[model samples]
Target: MILKRLIFALLIIFSFTSCTSDDDASTPDRRSIEDLETDFQALNLQQGINDVTLENLNGSSWNFRVIIPESASSTERPLVLTLHGAAGGDVDAHKNTACYAEPGFAALDPIIVSPNGGTQLWNSAFNQDLVIGLMYLTQKYLNVDRDRTVVTGYSNGGNGSWFYAEIYPEIFTASIPMASSYSTFSSNGSVRTIETPLYVIHGENDELFPLAETQEWVAATRDAGTNVTLEVAPGLTHYESCNYSPYLQNAASWLQDEVWD
Candidate 1:
């Protein structure tokens, strides 16, 4: 009887293991980039917003937000790359706050590309690679005007705008940095080498990044012969400076009339 019981227990265990293996085999695998591309092709990409995930050569991935206006189907529109602050790891928040969010990047009528920073700061080799890859993808797939590409961001994102503008000035036409100062670049006049115009916006009463530092940096950059415009919002703080969708339209207009001139 004992021998019979042992054989029955072994049979039950083997049956359970086989069932588990079958279950594992039945589960579907994750979709590949090809699958995603196929899905994207089916969408009406000329209107509304799309949240995209793209894989890089290093097998890493990028999650970004793309805003395609109604004009994208017929017109080669300008592209604005908006970076995010230290708040989050994804582009969701930045997508909601960038020039493409609610007011519609209005008069600018540009395609907005906002990417996740992946880190708290923006000065990294991984981020640089990601930006280059993203730019390539945008140029190849989207109706992006390469000559009029703009880079803008707030806080930490603003720091990225300044850093990338200095490093890759050839790709960008102008930069709008809000409540940010030179992060990796110092006052050694290195920013003077930038050919792209800069519009520096800040709050007068910011406690995190004081307006005084920004003033000094802008003064130094200007002294270095870099074309720059400074706009200060009176009685505003570092946190308050992010309310920009309403005011950025004017800034975009200025870029069209002044900087791109």
Candidate 2:
């Protein structure tokens, strides 16, 4: 009789422990925003570009560049994850390709991070998880305004912006994808309803990805109740990457005034 009673008690304890573990897994991080800001201030990071390498959850090392504005302080500032194009360049070259490290973006007073796309494109599962891990690491070391975090990219990176917004809506407040297409998600049948607002910028005369296709995708996404806007640049080509900076700056302004505000 005592053996049976002991077995029953063990089962009850195991059930309660399992329930507790499940609930704890679903609970949100209990750290306050102030605590995060304090931790960032402790870093004493200088105002300029810094090269950083962090290990992802999969034990792979990822290289990225961070641009800290002069105005950064203990107060939480907006974070912009600027993905680079898949042009087979190093992180330094990629950061400059899309004007992400330019003065224009710095004027917005947001901490910009540009990550190098590894052997695969940003839409790949490995790269996607790497991006997520980068964000988490950034949050750990920087005073990021979680409500105003943004994801923006150019060309291949632009496709990634859309992918992250669609797959991780809860992490980003908005996305700005420039000179990109919907091929990645559409081809994989991964298109779904996205709540994060999107500001898409594509050249009207884009030679690689047709402008019409982006318009069609935007229309479909809008019809599905997504807060999305498409801005077409006239006489702009795919290779005119630097020229897109002004348009991206405009989009950033819109995000500030419309979404973050």
Candidate 3:
């Protein structure tokens, strides 16, 4: 009888161990994409600058900044992703100071997102994927109005804006690229016909990116059934074109007319 009891106890122990092992194996290794997307929707974001890091689907991470206006609400608001020049600058320079101080844009009270492209031009496939992922996160978590999402950038960022708008035509409501022009990045049917109206802002006297290239690219995009408009600053240089507050306001107004109207 004692021997029989010992054997039965060993059998029970082995069965339990096997079942536990199987249960552990059945558990998921990672969160679903849908769940991950909405995971931060309830995040408590404060007004002003909030530096944060987000993980993209490909297991890569992005360090970006978000600027929330003081008058921000829980209701849906417009979201603008501003790309910096080749300088790899921070968000405070782009959002709180330059953009918020602008007239029309300040009144619009949109949430501004500026990403760190890490000292490189915004030309990487990883950056491209991160940008799209950032937009998805912002719209889902930050109360962004999906229909009013816009993109604008200066110099390198400007090139990024044009490139992204072409590749992901359905992602944005409008695109404004300052002191930049189209390149092989957006050419050769690499990007679909831009569904969003694109406003190309360049300095006629720009020495870095030639004005001739800007006009030619704009014309080609127009020929490809894209509703594009080019605005040239008469005497402004590439740097001045980005800092000219009035022109930034004008771009904001044009975006408002296109989507908010």
Which candidate achieves the best lDDT against the true structure?
A: 2
Q: List the residue pairs that clash in candidate 2.
A: none
Clashes of each: 0, 0, 0
TM-score of each: 0.77, 0.77, 0.75
Cα displacement (angstroms), candidate 3, residue 145, comes to 1.2
Q: lDDT per residue, candidate 1, 102-165, as tens digits? A: 4535687888888887755775656665565566557657887777888888888888888878
Q: For candidate 1, report its TM-score.
A: 0.77
Over 1-261, each residue of candidate 2 has an lDDT whose tens digit, in order, gives 322332343344334323434556566544333443354345456778777665433334567777777666657878898888765756464457335436445556888878888667887656665566557656656767777889988888889999889877777889999999864235566545678899999999999999988998888778778899999999999988778877887887887789988
Overall lDDT per candidate, in order of appearance: 0.69, 0.72, 0.68
Q: Evaluate model 2: give its TM-score.
A: 0.77
Candidate 3 per-residue lDDT over residues 56-157, each given as its tens digit: 443445677787876567667777888877754453434433542334367578888887776556757556655665676676567667778778888888
Error of 3 at 169 (Å): 1.8
Q: Which parts of model 2 are misplaced by more than 4 Å?
A: 1-45, 87-91, 97-101, 183-191
**Candidate 1: regions farther than 4 A off:** 1-46, 87-91, 98-104, 183-192
Worst 10 residues of 3 by lDDT: 1-10
Q: Quote the lDDT for 240 in model 1.
A: 63
